[model samples]
Target: MKLSIERAALLRAVARAQSVVERRNTIPILANVLIEAEGDEIKFRATDLDIEVVDNAPAKVERAGSSTVNAVTFHEIVRKLPDGALVSLTDDGASGRLNVEAGRSSFALATLPRQDFPVMATSEYDSTFTAPAPVLRRLFDKSKFAISTEETRYYLNGVYMHVADAEGRQVLRCVATDGHRLARIDAELPEGAEGMPGVIVPRKAVGELRKLLEDDEMKIEVSVSETKIRFATPEITLTSKVIDGTFPDYSRVIPQGNSRKLEVDASDFARAVDRVATVSSERSRAVKMQLDEDRLILSVNAPDAGNAEEELVVAYADEKLEIGFNAKYLLEIASQVDRENAVFLFNSSGDPTLMREGDDTSAVYVVMPMRV
Candidate 1:
């Protein structure tokens, strides 16, 4: 394949495509990015057999052909090219090398047959809908932190996305949990997404999708099927297989009867938790919260590392409540509160507690308490 593309445009396309290519691959061809040049555009495709990302950039085509080369190497070469310089890529099928040239720099990358690259098969989507980039970004960004990393419970290793009833309205929802903490976020359902099948978007796919949502004005087209899910923008398309498992019913995990209320500044609360946690042991980072009237005190005691306590004036009017929680969990959950103070509802020191930003029920978090 032979084509000339602007350095900035080429690097952006290749960088997005190659980010999914794993450096170490059992199959050599899996490490290569497929380059196809035709008409007035060039396409860069890379996959790890599970997730495939294809990006297209406008180019001046010299010859219509295709070639495969190391995704990482090609990305690095294009990245180092001077800004505004035109880059030329030529493939000598006979020599099995792809030549890259920009200004005074030139290098040839070993090539593989384009036929050896494994492209993920397409699927008949059950539902397809469009959403504002910022809406999708909030849904995934708020809940992804709780996705489980345990390989055994594969179902919990991704964000569970589906349609559900919220406050008598059907809303699109994303839920994720690692058994210790759970996050549930809801957005208004799109017109064509009523029949969308529930799918567990794998952890890696969630991360890849985040990069595409940086542009708030961009509209994303999302397609979902029983086996696969695809997110597409004008210049790029990302496709991945949905985890083949059933997500457990997570409704029971969200505490409903917890009524002891405590409202505290989210940022201040997070900072206080961090300071107290500094004295906590690495293994069990437990922080005790004492609440009475309008006062809240956070304390941590580690046998070998010493102890710390900090008092903060908060809005708590219920009977005195004391609870212990994993310091890290409290900090993470508190950070999600963006607009208003974080409101914490407690059932007891032993039951799961609910937290949310101000009075917004759209996004709710549940955390199981730990014994101090």
Candidate 2:
């Protein structure tokens, strides 16, 4: 395969492909990226058995052929090249090496047979829909932080995407939880997405999808089947297998009858929690919230370390309540509030608390309380 591509274009394609390649591979070909050059374009494909990404870049093709090379090495070489320089890749098929040349620098990388690369098989999608980039971005970005890292409960390790009824209308929703906290975000359902089956998008796939959603004007084509999910754009395609398990019914986890209400500025609340937690025990990192009338006091006490306390004037009219929570969890949940005020609903000191941005029900968060 022989082709010449601009350094910027080459670097963009190779960097994306290399991210899908696993560093430690049991199979030799799995560590390499498949490069195919044909009329006016070159394609870079990489997979780690579960997730696959293919990136296309415009190139001047000298010959129509295909080759495989170490993805990490190719990316590093292209990244270090001078900007605007044209990069040439050539493989004679006779020699076991691929030649890379850019200006005065030249390097030869060992090549693997293109036939050895395992490509994920195509699936018959049950649902296909188009959605604006910003809409999809908000759905995933707001909920992915709560995805569970525990491997045993594989179902909880991904964001659940499905169509659900919200306020008497069907909406596209994404929900994620790690038992301690949960994030549920809703967006307008696109046309033809009414009957789509719910899919658990794995954590790695969610991270990679973020790159494609950076362009606000770009439109993303999403295809989903019982076992696979694919996100495609004009230049890039990402495909992954859905987690093979059922997500827990999260409705029960979100408290509904919480009577006490507290409205506080999200930024000020997060900062106060951060400062007070500084002197907390490393293992616990717990901060206590004492609410009385319109005053809220945040305090952290540790026997070995000094204690810290901060007070903020909030809007709380209900009876006094004291609750303890992990400082990290509170900071994370509070930061997700986009609006100036974050509303917290409490039932008791031990029950899970519900939080949302003002009165916006579109995005809601639930965090379990801990003992002080």
lDDT of each: 0.93, 0.94
Task: Residues 1-372, candidate 2: write the lDDT tens digits.
Answer: 888999999999999989988899989999999999999999999999899999999999999899999999889889999999999999999999999999999999999988899999999999999999999999999899899999989899999999999999999999999999999999999998987999999999999999999999999999999999999999999999999999999999999999899999999999989889888668357899999999999999987889989999999999989999998899999989889999999999999999999999999999999998
Which of the numbered candidates is closest to the native, going by highest lDDT?
A: 2
lDDT of 1 by residue, 219-338 (tens): 999999999999999999999999999999999999889999999999999999999899866735889999999999999999888999999999999998889999988888888888
Q: Considering summed lDDT, which 10 consecutive residues are worst modelled in model 1?
A: 277-286
Record all residue pairs in model 2 with backbone atoms less than 3 Å apart, i.e. clashing. Answer: none
Error of 1 at 345 (Å): 0.5
Candidate 2 runs further than 4 Å off: 281-284
Name the regions of candidate 1 deviating beyond 4 angstroms. 281-284
